[model samples]
Target: MRKRATAKEVADAAGVSKWTVIRAFTPGASITEESKRRVLEAAAVLNYTPNLLARSLATNLTHQVAVFVDDFANPQKLPFLETLTERLQAEGLVAVLININNHFDHVHALLNADQRQVDAVILFGTAFRNETLSDRQLGRGMPPMFVLARDSQIDGVPAVVCDAELALRDIVDHLYERGYRRPGFMTGAPALSTALRRRQHFIDFWKGKGVDEIAILSADRYSAEAGAGSVRHYLNDIDPAARVDVLMCENDILALGAMDEIRGNFGLRIPDDIAVVGFDNYELGGASCYGLTTYEQPRIEMVQAVIGMIKGRLEPETVTLPGKLVVRTST
Candidate 1:
């Protein structure tokens, strides 16, 4: 194999010092236009490219972020990750995606990104523990860390999340206005902090309204199939007269699944027999077939907030955005 060209070779070919070659390649370094042009010409001739890893070592910034995610089956995670990567790319940053299944995996991913000199780390899933993030036993010198979509507080870590408690209040109010007295919640897993909070919020909101009876069911996963299976099981045992008037799914995908089961398998009319609602107003939720009544989770706002935290525009504290309701044919 041919030996790779070095900055020294480019400098020699350009008739300039190696310092001039380095400055010319640097984004905002002080260099004369003529020298930069000559350096560019020499680099082109030699097919020389700056070593980003070496540059990061010298500057102490990689312009690379590590994103830790889980639950590949969740329909919303892909879109959320895509939006995050695109926004980071727009700001001249690169994203390295790491799929972690549990808290131990999260720790490993963090350590690995730190070793690789990542500028920041973002947790895009629900399995990480807030306490584990700040444990002193972990190695020192971690990059700026954040959690998205879920609210968690570590001393130096911030989370950009929608206000789920407040959002559930809006959902409860809407359900009440629509004459839904008996409501139920369908969640993927109760182990997740986000899911637990959302579940409790629904129960507390309904109890506060003097509605003592409510049903809550947890699916094995967040997939549409799981949603359909859980709903099917939920309806089998309940008496027809005591059935839940409204079923509030934890997310749009789950709601979509439940809606399909109710219409397709159970042969029930939406909004007439059972009004269905969901959160995270996914794109398909607004389609003509579903027209789901769901909460609008501010993805753009959360992404921008994460970027601000990465750039030090915002402090390391949780930022909660309000939720908006989109009423459609579902409710």
Candidate 2:
């Protein structure tokens, strides 16, 4: 291994105190401009990389924020991350992405925070209302935590939430006002916050109309194929006498997939036999094949709002963003 240069060597080369070299690396540390320039010059000449851990102990700040996201595989999360990173960069803070599959992984960040590897932590996509996030281990922290999801307020962490119920209600009311009934739902899991809100919206709407039952299906993946497969399952399982008049997919992919399966396999006409509605009206939903009726929540606005919450230094609180529904040919 190559011999590593030390801070003492840089201090000798720059003709300054060892503490002077440390202050240059620490954010908001008081140091003369001339001294900082000398340290930078000495560091360049000696090819020295500052020991971030030691500096973190000196300042009690790592200046690096850890971001916990469900998984990058979900396309919807990518944009949110990109926007958040841009904002974090603008604030002169590093955003480190940590994939959250294990519940106890968040605790690791706290350990890192103490060591000055990561400062604050931001959690994305997954809600904290469930047991995994509500647990004391996951909630306690050395670094402040912020959740980016709908219906947040997980234990100790403040939430950057969305108005999912209002969004769903608006979409449902729009369809109902347009003289549509017998709406069905497609969702994969009951535990997810977004899925629960959408699924319950259909129930409350129909129950208010004196309807006894509403057709529903569970999806495995948030993809077009999953949507298509879910519709197939519903078709095979539902009673022929009380088929769904409309399908309200929890996401755009499902709405588009169900529409394709309905058109290609079952040979049913859309908006005639059944109208379809979906959320997150992504590019696929807007495609000519789907032209899906869906709710377009302030996607970019939501991203900005969460980033804003994260950017706020020490003054942490909950933030709620608005959403809107759009009518298309599918309805």
Best by TM-score: 1
Compute the lDDT for candidate 1: 0.85
Model 1 TM-score (2 dp): 0.92
Which run of 10 residues does model 1 get worst, by summed lDDT? 188-197
Give TM per candidate: 0.92, 0.79
Q: Which stretches of candidate 2 lie over 4 Å from their true place?
A: 1-5, 25-28, 47-49, 69-73, 100-117, 125-142, 192-196, 205-213, 239-241, 299-315
- Model 1, range 173-258, lDDT digits (tens) per residue? 98998889999999875444323378789999999999989988778777889899999998897888888989999888889999
C-alpha local distance difference test of each model: 0.85, 0.72
Clashes of each: 0, 1
